[model samples]
Target: GEYEVLGEIGRGAMGVVYRARPVGTNLVVALKRVEASGLEGTEAVRRFREEVENASGLRHPHIVPIYHVGEQDGRPFYTMALIGGGSLEQKLGQYQADPRAAVTLLAKVARAVHYAHQRRLLHRDLKPGNILLDEAGEPQVADFGLATKLDPGGAAAGGPMAGSLPWMAPEAVRRDATLTTAVDVWALGVILYELLTGRRPFGGKDRSEMRTGILQAELIPPRVVNPRVSRDLDAICRRCLESDPDKRYESASALALDLERWLRDEPVRARNTGRLERLVKWTRRRPATASGLTFLALLLVAGIVAAVTMANEQDARLRQEVCRGNEFAARHVASTVLAQLQHFGEAVEGTAASTKLTEACDGGDWPAVEELLKARLLDTPPGPGAPPFATAFVLDPEGIIRAECPQRHRVVGGDFRDRDYFRGARARADRPEGERVHLSRVFTSKNDGLDKLAVSVPFRLKSGGPVWVLGATVPTDATLGVGGLHDKARKAFSVLLAPRESDGEEYVILVHPGYESREPSVPFPAGRLRPTETGFAADDDYADPVAARHPDYRGRWLAGFAPVPGTDLVVLVQQPYDEAVAPYRAFFRKFLEWLVAAAVVGALLVAGLWLSRSGHGARV
Candidate 1:
C-alpha cells in the first residue's frame, strides 16, 4: 500500500512487472503480479505462491533478491531489488565487439547459475534479457518465473514445456524426455554464442523455422563468422552449443572455468575431436555427408514408391465404402428407436387427456389420476431386449409429482419442480402449438444412482395457462438399442446419444456402448465415454484438436451428427482416423523398413567400391 504507481517494465502471460517506489523511501523496487485479476484460480494462485517462494530463497550477489511477497485483489505479487543498468540483451552489440568483456559477463552469470543449481533450482529460461546488470555494471540473474527444481536422481521433468523456443534444448522442444538442469546449461550456451556472434546460433525469421534450426541445423563456428574470434574462445562457445546436452559442458561451473581459461589465454579443456571420434561424429556434424546418404536412400526406394501409391488409393476407396455403410445403418437405427418412444407417448397422451383424468391432474389429485391411468392405458411390455420403463409420472404446474404409474416407489407427493424435464417442457410452452414434448438431459438420479432421461410433454386443462408435464424415465441403452445400433457390424465405429447441459452450453455424453452406464458393453469399448471436446457453445472453436477427435482415440477422426427431431439432441457417430488411414500407415511402415534396408545396402556397396579403387591406385 505504501508503494506509488510507476510505469510498467515488462508484461508476460503470467503477469506484469512494474518499476515502483515506496511512498516514503528513496529505494525503488520491481513489482511482479503473479497473474492478472481475470486469470485468478486456486491452482494458478498456488503455483504463483510456490514460484515466488523458490525465487526468494536464493542469496547470491549476482542473483536478484526478493524484498516482499504479497497479494492484492486475489492476485499474488512480489517485489525485488530494481537493477539500474540495462539488460544483457541491450548490450549485445557492445559485448560482441569486446571478446574480453563478453566472456567476463558470461562467466559471472554462469557462476550465479551454478550457485542456483547447487540449491536444486533450475532456471529453465536463460536468455540474455533475463540477465541484468546492477548499478556498478555487474551481471545479476533475474526472472525465476519459469524455474523448476532439478531431480536428485537427474530424471527429466515431465511437466509442460518451459523457456523461449529459440533458446530451448532439443529434449525440451521434443518433449520426449524429462527436463533437467542440462536445459539451462544449453540455454546459457545459446546466450554466450549469441553475445559472441551478435546473433542466435540457430537463427530464423519465425519460431517454427527457429525450432527446425535448433533441432537440425549445424553450428556455424564463431571464428568463421567473426575472424577476430580466437580459436580458444571459438571452441568454448561451440562446446556450450553442442546439440546433445551430455556433449555440452556438464555444469555451468565447468562452462565458467573454460571461459575463464579463454580470457587468460591458457589452453581450454574443449578442443577438436581426434580422427576416430571425428569419423564417428562425421554423420552428425557434417550435413553434406548425411544429405548425400539421404539422397542415395531415396533413389534406391524410387521403384517401390509407385506400388505404395497404388495401395494408398485402394485404401481410400475401401474406407469410403465402409463409412457409407456405417452411416446408413446408424441413421436407420436411431430413427427407429426414437419413433417407437414418441408413438408410445403420443398414444398415452391421446387417451388420458381426452378423459376426465385431465381435471384430476390439473388439480394435482394424484390418487384420482392413478386410477384413471390404470383403467385406460395398457401396460407397455418388457420387450425381448428392451429395458423396462423405470418411471411413468405426471407433474402439476408447480412441478410436484402428482401421480406415478407402476407405483413401485412412494413418490406421489414428492417435488420434481427442479427436475430438468419439467423445466425444459415449461421453456417450450411459448413455442407454436405443434411442438412441445421436451426430452431432458441425461443425469444421475440422486436417490437411485443411475443415469436416465425424462421424456416430458406439457398439457393444459383443455384450456388455461396452468401446465401439467407428463414424464417417463427411460434408460439411455433403451434408445441406443432401437435398431441394433451397437451390434457386431459397428464394432469399428462409435455411435452415441448426446445432449446439451442445462446449466451450460457444453455437450455431455448421454448414451453410448462405451459409457459406463451402458451395460453389456460393445466389442471395442472406448476408454472414456465422456468427450473432452464435446460442446455446443456459441463461440466454440471447431478446429480445436479436442473437438476434432474422439476422446478415446488419437489422430484425426471422422464424425457426423444428426439431430433428434423435436428435441435439441443428436445421434453422434465417430470412428478412428486410423479406420481410413490404417491401411496406408501399415503399408508405409513396411515400405519404409524395406527402403532403409536398401539404402544401407547401397551405402555399403559404394563404400566397398571407393576402397577397392583407392587400393588399386595405391598399388599403381
Candidate 2:
C-alpha cells in the first residue's frame, strides 16, 4: 500500500474509506478510494474530482476539511482530516433521551450545511452516518459524495438523485420533484428525530412502504415519543420535516438559528405558532371536514368562553395581588431612598453651617477648608460599611472648585458654573431659608465618571455675601443608597426616575439595571402601566401588539410607582406580568386542551346515535 492503512472506517455508495497515515508524513487522515463499481468511468471520475474540488473549498470548523486529492492505480481518492471519535451513527445511543444534547449537536451540523448552501452546493445526503465526531465530540459533516452544485437559480442540475431512502425528503421520493436545498434540511430533521427519540420519524419494512410513510404518514411528534422533548424542539423538528418543501425552513441557517434559540432559552420561531394559528392551518387543509366539525367546535367554544370568564376572574385576583405587592415594594423603596437623601442633605447642611469652615474660608485658608470637608464627608461614618459620599468639595462664588477632599489636583481649578447643582445653590436665596439644601439632577461626575447626585448647600463667610457652595456627591450605583432599595424585592426590579427640566422627554432614568448609561424615557407602553386617580394601575388588556412585536420589549410588566416624599424623583417597581398570571394562564391552556378533546369524542357519539336512529327508521 502506498499509504499505510491503519484500519477500514467504512464502505459507502461512493467509496471505501480508511483511516490511513499518508506516505512520508506524520499526519493521520481519512482517505476515500472511489472504487464503487459503476463510478469507475472517466466522466464519473471527473465529476467526483469536481465534487471533491468544491468540497475542498468549504472551510468550516464543523465541516470536514479536505487536504488532498489524488489517484493511484486508476482509482481516484481524496484525503480529509481524520475524525477519530467515530460517526454520529455510533454515538446516537448516548443522546437518545437528551434533547438538549441532540439540539446542541445538530445546530452545529445544520450551520455547516447552511454554509455549503451559501456557496451554491447541496449536501443531498446528510445522514447521521455522514456526520463524524472528532476527539472533542464536535460533529463535522463528512461524505459529500451525493452533493450537488446548484445552478444560479438554486436548482440542482440534472442527475439521478441519490439519497438513503430513510432520510430522503418526501419530494425527493417522487421522480418528478425538483431537487433543492430543502432535501438537506429534511435529512437533518430525520437525524435530529433519531437523536432525540432513538428512532426515525418515518420507518417501514421496505423501501416502498417507507416512501409511502414518508409521503403520507402523520408524524408522531418528538415530544409524543420522548416526553422529555420540549414543545419548542418538537416544533422545530416538525418544521424541518414538512412534506411540502415550501413549508420547510427557508434555509438551513433558519433551522440552525431556531435550534440555537431553543438552546439559549429564548423565543423560537417554530414555537410562536399560536393554537389558533395551528387550528386555522389545519382547517384550511381540510375545509369540508372542518365544516362538519364546526357545530362541535362551537359547543367547545361556548365551554371555552365560560372557562375563560372564570380564568379572567382568577387572573384579576392575581393581578390585584401582584399590583398591591409591587405598590408596597415601591413605597418601601421610596421611603428608604428618601431617608438616605435626607441624611445626605443634613450632612451637607451641617458642613455648610460650620463656624470653623467659615473662619477658614474667610481667612483664605483653603487647606483647612479641604480638611474639614474630608473629615465630615470623606471619612467613613460609624454605621456605613464604606463612606457614603464619593467626594466632598468647596466651590468659590464663581463656581470654581477652590478645594476638594481626596483631592484630584486637576479638578481643583475646574469651573462648574454651568452645572445644575452650581446654578441651583447660587439661586437658593429665592426659596425659604429652610429649603436651602438643593438636590441637583442626576449628573455624571467629571472626577470619577460615575452617576452622582449632588447635594449642594450654600453658605457665606459673612451674612448674605460671597456665598460659597458646599457639595457632597453620592454614587447612584452604591448598595448603601438609592439603587439598593430594591434588593429585597425579589419579584420586582426598581428604577429611579428624575423629573426632567428639558424638552421632548418625560424623565431621565437616574438608575436602571437594563441601561448601560443614562437614557431618556420612552412612553410607558400602553396597557402596561397607566395613571389612575388614586395611583398607578395596570390594564388587563392582553393584546398589546406593540410590546409583543418589539424586539426590545423585556416582557409585559405590571408596575407600581411612588414619589420620593420631598423630591421630584419617582421609585417605580415592575414585575413580569406573565409570571404574576402564570397559574391562570397554565390552567386555561390545559382546560382548552381537554375541552377540545372532549368535543371530538362528544361529536363522534352524536353522529353515531343519529346514524343509528336514521338506519332504524329506514328499516321500518
Clashing pairs in 2: none
Give the poorly placed runs of model 2, Cα more than 4 Å off: 1-294, 309-321, 381-387, 429-434, 478-484, 487-490, 500-506, 512-553, 603-620
What is the alpha-carbon lDDT for the whole of candidate 2?
A: 0.78
lDDT of 1 by residue, 1-620 (tens): 86775889988767788999888988889988865656466666666676797799999999998999877776789899999897988888987889899899899999999999998888888888889998787999988877777778655464666788888988888875577677888898888888878988898889889889988999899888888888888888888878887888889999999999888877788975366676668877646555666678668667467757776687667556655554555455557657755764564455335547687865767777776555544255323344445566777888887788767565677887878888988886666654666778765554365566676677777666687777766654524435455544344443555443343344455556544433421222122223334221111111112332336544454454455555555555555555556667787779778877878887887667666867898999
The number of clashing residue pairs in each candidate reads 4, 0
* Best candidate (score: lDDT): 2
Q: What is the lDDT of residue 428 in candidate 2?
A: 92
